[model samples]
Target chain A: MTRDAIILAAIAGAGLLTVLLFAAGADGAPRAIAALLFLLIGPGLACVRLLRLDDPLTELALAVAVSLALETIVATALLATGSWSAGAALAALVAITLAAVAAGFARARGAGSPRA
Target chain B: MAAGVPGPARESAGQAVSSSPGPAALAMAWPVGRAPSWLLTLAPLLAALALWLAAIPAIDPDQMTDLGLIAVLPPAFYLALGLLILGFCALLGRERAGDWEPGAYIAAWIVILHGTPAIVYGSLRYAWAWKHVGIVDYIQRTGGIDPAIGYLPIYHNWPGFFGAAALLTEAAGLADALPLATWSPPFFELLFAAALLLVLRAVTGDRRLAWLGVWFFTLTNWVGQDYFSPQAITYALYLAAIGLCLWAFPARMPLAASPVGRVVIRGALLRRLAADFDRRAEWAGAASSALPDLSTVQRRGLLAMTLALLASIAVSHQLTPIVTILALFALVLLGQCRAWGLPLVMLLFTAGWMATGASSFAAEGIREVLSTLGRANENIDSNLIDASLFTPGFRIVSNAARALTAGVGLLATLGWLRRFHDGYLDLPLTLLWLAPVALLGMSSYGGEILFRVYFFALPAMAFFLAALFAPRSWRRGAASLIVVALASVVLAAGFLVAYYGHERSNYFRPGEIAAADYLARNAPAGSLIVEGSPNYPSRYHRYEQFVYVPLVAWPRGNVEASANAYSLADIEQMMADRHYAAAYLIITESQKVEMSVPGLASLEAIQGEIEASGDFAVLFRNDAATIYGLAGRQGAEP
Candidate 1:
């Protein structure tokens, strides 16, 4: 698989695993690590992969920064609106991640190459 | 633009076309010619890690003198640090050294430098870090923010970091944010390295210079702002935003095309002094051609990401957004960046946030903040605690920190001049390096504005510091490598003393933590907790439940008043107030160490006086701490 394909696959897998773990009411290192990886990189990778930044370090750095910013905005808005719920926040983030991933895939397909 | 070479200096040295090691590789043939470059780097890193782990338990914090942790740290720790520095220098001088090797070396350097204190110190190091953790705890417990809270209202007003931390802590199923606070130094230092790489790569293709810059940043960043706080996160975002702007947004138009550009170009001496490379006729073609090859959609996406990072910084920190605004304006003014609208957007975000979320804090402090404007000397004086009050060992440590800062400044000046003389218009880096100085005239920030200025300028300063090692000729490559290595070792020595020397007061004991925890669990809401000083871990739980009053006051630029002597009568008078339902006085070893200055009554003397008065009884006592309350108050009994 190309690097793009591998990253997309990891995101999808991690996203699914995080949701399942949350549903199962798991509360330990496994659940925490999975949630951390998903939150820190899944949405960011889905967003930044569209930019086509090839450098690993820059990509990783931007991904983390974007991810943290997204989390802050989502959490802040929820708290400010008086509708705070960790599960709801996580669900909203996961929804955003999936939406971005779908958009990335659609853009790649529209370019007439699945590998692009 | 430089064809992926490191610098124009390397180009002048006749090795611009190749990435091979120069004469320096042959100089090491007698010792380790047969070893692979990765092994050469990783072996020392691993050995250092092993040695450092072994050395941590050997360190006894009680043995630490005024020189801080350096006095108590085993010699093995020093050996480990030396090995890492020498190994990185070797890797940098080797034949066909890849990014992974030197990157790993620098990573190991941070792990050793920042991680040692993290692992050895059983609890969090700084009092401020514990206070931040309390903010996170508040958010998690309340599930909301109280911007007008009596305690830590400023944090509540700008609670982005605390809110995000709360979400992560709950998601991770952690009970508290203490672990995050414990490992924050290394985590933030690593984040800084990544962000700095983006900034450096955007400026120069020289991998050697970029890596060395990161290394130098790690060694010289003795400012201690990397504790688990909003500053750490916002600073990372600040660097990332600048790096993204520089890498992707070079100004597209020539200097003569714009009005400001035309005015700058019309002045001969001003043009030479600015020396903006894009304005040069010869470099104009390459500068325009070197812009990142991204589609319009991608560029817009990147721009959105940059704005998001900026918005994050705006909401999270009070000072970084201003620094970001100044830096972006500098970049645009020098024609180094094309994002002319970025500073304006940043201004909007800052002003909007202040008008809304942070308005409470701004409203209360606006007058005081305005009064400090243009008071540069007073602002700078706030950052300097009274050096005369320090013990002899700490005085040396303080001087070493000053010397290190001065050395970096001196070397950076030389490096800037050399780059300018070589026909390289390094005006962007120079402007960025000087941009944070603007804040020195803005506010004293509780005597920390000067340190914050140093922290923000360090990335640019580290770049110039690395420029000193960019060899002028291949024949000097070996000599350059040696000089770089020696410089790093000397800085690392100073860094140890400057960064770790204050562990005597910074490091908290388990007994001290226990006393604080006891007070946290037992103290009633609206009770009064009299503290010896604000330098110990005081507010990690139920912090808002009680009022905290420190005996030693730290007013603006009043070091003498900060060491005021407190008597038993004064305490009785203060605690006897009928307004508070109950009151207790707590003293700890860390507070004693911190308040050991002249003119301050020792915590022990106060304890003895209280014990003799027979009006207050000891609620709790440990080797490292004691908590006392009025003899007749039922709430005082623990």
Candidate 2:
């Protein structure tokens, strides 16, 4: 599959998983697994693009680290601003993921190639 | 260099590539063909997974008795463990791991390797885990932290981890952070594997050593700090931070400029002041890692981003920031880092946070940290001895944990000895490994400082451990294979000791959580809710709803009023005391097992006493748990 197509598919999968996750509402193993993928997918892809590292495992690891730090920053901002809510936090995460993934792809395109 | 598999391994001087023929050529000449296929290496992992699947049905949380995760698992668990160990040896035994594919395969095995008990376990086991859920729930409900002066002050002060969980739980529309806790071990282990590999490569620039170090780390990591906790996230960030720093901005200074001109760095002052920097060593053999890997702008951006990560860590956990500060400074001092400004920035952020956001919690530690400057043993003992909960094989587990740690220490020492043997000189890495131990002089972190020290030091130690194999000396393929497997088995044994060490206390029941939730929901605000012991899932949710009074506070020091109310006869007098008013007492299944097995108390006698007494009435009762409301003096007189 094309790289763009894969990214789109991942986003779509995340969307589907997000809907299924909410629909399921409580706990089930599959949705839980889906939740893991959905939360990590965008950030993971973004990390791969932004890190510009050769190793996929190393890229993924940095992505988790960056995503966590970003999430913490967002959460801290929300708490500090008195705007902290579940909705606000989720929006911040999605926004950060989208921006990061977009910047990563842009960097890749500007460099005229993609490693991940 | 030690010849590992892949492309013709990097050779030293005009020497033939291997002590035998070559790793690949040796393998071909020995029993195996060119090399063992990936499928053969994967077989043991796949088989181990199957055994784990078979053992799941045998898990009975009801009869959890003194034993924990081991009880429900079958002998197949042992077979699976054997398979994992065998698979590791088989993978390394082939004398290859030069490519990323093999590393990926190993990571896959790691996921399976750690996933067994993590997935099969019934519910969240650790007592602190339930409280973590509650912390997230609290944050979700109210975005601000509730200042906790005593118990959970650190998490509350830096609510980054809990805040993220709250967001994820919200985004996923999950009830709580239960799934996160359940699946955390394997997921974190996999991510950690990636990060550790990056560090190993950065330090040695050898893929083989990196891969071997990662596998060794997994086998030996008996420290269970990676479970759904802030340390898990911070540990990942810590490694990522180190990678970004070392990869992007490695300094130009090589320790040995004059091969014949010896420079012995002995005391602390000399090490600190010994920065003469041999300018004539331009002809030194070691290639400069000083050149920026990325463009200047990109490198600067990465450094800026790393500082932000440090800021987040500073805000999240209390201890990790200290470790980060020490590491960054070590880098700067050793000339492994160009940016001296970064450590100062980290220091300001850490000290700045401690003064402002973390002030409420810091007041309690100022004197203790001052007085306990060199009392590492006392600090270590306080944590281990005070928090020890006895179950069946506690001694065996404790000894195994000690042996595992000692074995690691020995291997790291061997790395130094090997440095003398191989004529390798890099004192900075050794200094970095020892840096976290300095944290011992800091507060004991309520006895857990030692474990945290170990956690932070693992990456550095892994690098040194990689040295045990003649990885750089390509000819010593056989020795490399033997050394790597022996290291793996040692760590695997440690993994057993660490994971199984606190099974009884770590495993919690659904009913225990149910009773705690009931108290959270039903108990009037600020009312006293007494537990038979502090083992139940209480105070994690709606912590302020009731004053949590345990009948017996074991393993944690405060036994005053709790010790006085251990029996039914004492229950009457205990209720009449001014401190006792409209209090509910809970007795749980795990509590009963704990009481009887340890001979702490007779559950039957306590139950019988409750039945005979008129001063108490059952408020809520289940087969697994019971809640009673003390009537105080009203029932006592009548």
Candidate 3:
């Protein structure tokens, strides 16, 4: 696979891991382990992707997007566990979905494309 | 490649020779990308946690909670609302065929940069929850049960509102009501962050720059420390409105025939229709050349955003009509007449709606604008003195050669000038529109509330700073460094003032908490505990039933009766009549002066006479306070 595909896969995998950890419950040993894992793994893969890219701006945007996604995922997982109410849960979902879709579409347009 | 020794140069010039790669390029190729995305995201959060943990030894959780309660909500909610509004505005801009990114960028930058710190500070200081403890106690006393049980409507008391809301939610069977206290601030912060990001991305078109802006703003000391204030919420509302306005622009204007054409082609329906079409084409051509037509969707979006902006402002915990007006004016400038005129009109109407909808402090709100203007004038004068390049010879000589340092002296003056310029312009514009209302608040003349109302300019100040100093390139790093250094010094000064200033001793300390515990444990039930004066010391023992009676009130048997009677003689008579089980006399330095006064001296003499008569026994004695009990009093006495 191309390096770009590899990076995307890694980001997706990290996102999935975060989702699972959040789903598993955010307390005690399990949540702590998940948080540590994400904290370590997520930024690691993101940096790799950034270094492989030629454009600094794109790299930064990708890094920020990943970070935002990670936060969203953790927050969502916490909400899903009934930690937050239905209204809040819905709001979070909507916000995350919108952001993710926008990011994904932008990414698909090719890295380092000058903004219109 | 000089002509004198040009053999190699000539050969290379004839045959194009490529130079070897440079060291910088080679260094850039190194495999230095080990850190993953999630790690980068978590880094700041971890750093914050570490800092908090490090400070844990010195910082008390209770004290932190007190700060958190006041600083968190306003900024967070405002940012969140701003984001939603921005999205709608973006949609509007698309329809109107206007570039709405600049407005969005400004809105997002303000919300994220300012909103983050507000959340952090609010989380730290949670004691604001206790501000309404008296109201709760009053309710309990009157109702003869837990006040939370009754669903009685409370007025504009924040704590009461939270308590009542929590109780109601709990009644509806929500688990873990306690967590809501912690969750509320962070939840709002997250919402604000999201909104800020969204709006920024829309406006800048470059998401990376938007993120940078967000990070830069959040890292500022003011944002980190003052999140719990109502200004944060006002900011969020303002941003949301801006976003909505961006969304309102129509992608394309509706095509319509001219009135002259319709009148001329009155007969033959087909001919009339043809004429109408031709006229419409002419009009479209003219409009397209003059201004970009907006789509219906964009117009509706802007309308929606405008409404949202108004709603957010109206519902803000702190009344911020001044901020709302400033933002509205900004929108007008942004709209640039013609096509934007309609939106401006709509915004004005919405603002009117918000003004009418504001529930509390409506009459006193105007003072904020006046005070803002006053402070602005004061600041301008101060800046002029500080900014003057030349000083009188005597004054300069007296200060020594240390009067100016090359690096900071010039830059500081420049920074001061920049700040002054922004403040002067913003302050006047804000006051001009808001002065009438501010006058009303001034007339009411409540101290802190008036100040709080006036401080609505804080968010605007933050936005101005961001606009002025946010670096777009490496060269601007110097400016950023200066700002950071100056802000740090200011923050350090604030800490010093808070820690060691004259009012420091007035704050409730751990020692006071211990004293309160002792009083609660040992004092007899239903026994009247009287303090010597109604001062900060008496307030420190507020948890206890300590009724502070002045020395002159000692002659009166009934403290409450004397206060109601409002006469010194009546107070003395009542004090003489009442039977107190115990009296706690707290004599601070301030009270010693009162003792020198003739009337107060006589009261003290009366206390001395009573003591000599063996009517009371000294229970506790300290330099700060002395507690005396009736000689015949027993532990079980009511």
What DockQ does each listed candidate score? Answer: 0.57, 0.45, 0.04
Highest DockQ among the candidates is held by which one? 1
Q: Rank the candidates by TM-score, best first.
A: 1, 2, 3
Please give the CA lDDT of all the candidate structures: 0.75, 0.62, 0.34
Pick the TM-score winner.
1
True contacts kept of 1: 0.52
User: Tens digits of per-residue lDDT for model 1 on B42-76?
Assistant: 77778888888888899887788888888988889
lDDT of 1 at A81: 67
**lDDT tens digits, residue span A7-77, model 1:** 78788788788878877888789978988888877777788887777667778888888888887778777
Fnat of candidate 2 is 0.53
lDDT of 3 by residue, B1-638 (tens): 11232111101011211111211122336564765533432333344334433432342322322122222234333334333323322221121212233333333434333333333333222222222233333322232122122121111211222223222222223332222333333333433444444434333332323443343333222212132323343444444444333322312221122232334545577566554443432322222221223445434433543453454343333334444554455334322111354345545543543354221223334443233222111111111222233223212321221221121223333433453442212222222224323534443422323333323333233233333443333222334434433443343233222211211112333333333345555664334544343322232122324344555442222112224333434433433344544434333332332222233343344445545766556665444344555555454122
Off by over 4 Å in 1: A22-25, A109-116, B1-8, B11-37, B252-259, B263-291, B365-383, B444-447, B473-476, B555-565
Chain B of candidate 2 achieves a TM-score of: 0.81
Encode model 2's per-residue lDDT on A41-92: one tens digit a residue: 5554554456554456655666677767777877877765557876666565
User: In lDDT terms, which candidate is top?
Assistant: 1
Task: Give the chain B TM-score achieved by candidate 1.
Answer: 0.90
- lDDT of model 3 at residue B209? 32
**lDDT for B217 (candidate 1):** 91
Off by over 4 Å in 3: A1-116, B1-33, B37-48, B58-129, B133-318, B321-454, B474-638
